[model samples]
Target: MAKGKHNPERKAVRHGTEKGSVTLGGRRVAVEKIRVRSVDGVEIPLETYQALQDPELLTRAALERMIHGLSTRNYAYGLEPVGDDVESFGTSNSTVSRRFIAVRQLKST
Candidate 1:
């Protein structure tokens, strides 16, 4: 730790696995492959999991999640977005900050 440098506190990410299925319009499609792991307690498709590995997809998901969390009262409180999260989502600090501002504006509206 640096004498004067500060590592901002951040929210903890809980990862777990659950068994489930992928549904389309509330119906499961047998043609597509599905896999289940404890993630948010929902069944996701294999493609969905693969897409999560894609940087572009992750950035989009991060932006969406940031907006949703930032605008929600329960999530807005004690929401500390660290650089690591931003970096892991394949986006920059400036972009994340911009998204935060957008969320704030939306919430204020």
Candidate 2:
């Protein structure tokens, strides 16, 4: 007899097939798209996205503003005297001194 071609199907057992849609988290919710407009009359589509993946971006923004304010004050008033009244002025004397040193170090770097 001629040998039959290799067929793994003859040695296999049939298993029950599964039929169902896989739901993730919960039932899928339909989201509506939003349209946006620019000053130049351009129509843009806005998508809902997660806020600030990098927290450092926010810190850098605030730090930039703080540095700008400090620089302006230093130039205008020649660095206010660090004394007991510093806290009443919205910042502590030690904190101000630390910030001054940190800025000087940053500039030197």
Using TM-score as the measure, which candidate wins? 1
lDDT of 1 by residue, 27-98 (tens): 122232344544345544456745333434333444565556543223323234443322222234455455
lDDT of 1 at 80: 42
Those runs of model 2 whose alpha carbons end farther than 4 Å from true positions after fitting are 1-90
Question: Against the hidden reference, what TM-scores do the models get?
Answer: 0.23, 0.21
lDDT of 2 by residue, 2-108 (tens): 48665444433223342222111111112232344554556543232222223333334334545667442333243333443222231334444555566568879
**CA-lDDT, candidates in order:** 0.41, 0.37
TM-score of 2: 0.21
- RMSD, candidate 1, Å: 19.1
lDDT of 1 at 16: 45
